[model samples]
Target: MKHLFSLLTILFLLSCASKAQNSSKEKKTYKVEKTNAEWKELLSPMAYYVLREAGTERPFTSDLNKNYKKGIYVCAACKTPLYKSEHKYDSGSGWPSFDRAVKGNVELDVDYKIGYARTELKCNTCGGHLGHSFDDGPKTTGKRHCINGVALEFIPKEK
Candidate 1:
């Protein structure tokens, strides 16, 4: 019937428009650049794996999960300050959960590694894979930045 044909055409056009919108999202660029060899030499095995290879660390395995000190967490790769201790919290997800990150220090992108869309978080300066951010978080930001321990280094506050 012509009605059925017209409905199908409308659906097809809507799908195409949705795809175009998704693809138009901005991409992030980093300032620091290095070859794989250079990164490997500068980072530890676990840090390199999580930061460069987009690998996840075993939950509750990082000492940072238990750390409750006044400090700032920096990228293990480029030492860029990403999150502050005040924003860190226990999400019971086995990773270091932060309510937020320092503005302009982290970048977000979509990842489909697990057959689903996830907000992938990366260090803006080094372009290293930090982890993912979720909508389920505290009232402060309502954003949970789940970061890998191996991908971060805590710098104690200078008293």
Candidate 2:
């Protein structure tokens, strides 16, 4: 039975090492780093929650959901231009939806927060959480970038 015990111990150690490696890979390093205090000072309470803590805003509550004026939607944390106004759509999912993001401006990650895998979208500049993207979208892209409205600041196009 000594050989069986040895093999079991080896397997346990291997599993532990694999888990550590996976956890390390999951830690994200952002280009824009800020302390909690700095983020609190720079953002509204809701914005801080959604951007920093990956909290979701209440749906249909954001004025941006209905806003269709021509302009760019920028990251509330960093003012990086993210989504063009033309990509915005009424997904009726309560949150603002976009068909796509500006190239190289958004990062997609896998999220298993709800016991299933989801595509979590973040700002490439600040690494701030924007929302989730799904396969169910318009024919143009077939990808719904369901974004938290509180995480964005709209800059209307000048007349």
Best by TM-score: 2
Per-model TM-score versus the true fold: 0.82, 0.87
Which ten contiguous residues of candidate 1 have the minimum total lDDT? 24-33
* Candidate 1 structure, TM-score to reference: 0.82
lDDT of 1 by residue, 29-123 (tens): 57998989999999999899999999999999999988889999999999999999999999999999999999999988789999999999999
lDDT of 2 by residue, 80-115 (tens): 999999999999999999999999999999889889
Task: Give the local distance difference test score of model 2.
Answer: 0.95
Candidate 2 to truth, TM: 0.87
lDDT of predicted model 1: 0.94
User: How accurate locally, in lDDT, is each candidate?
Assistant: 0.94, 0.95
After superposition, the stretches of candidate 1 with alpha carbons farther than 4 Å from their true spots are 1-28
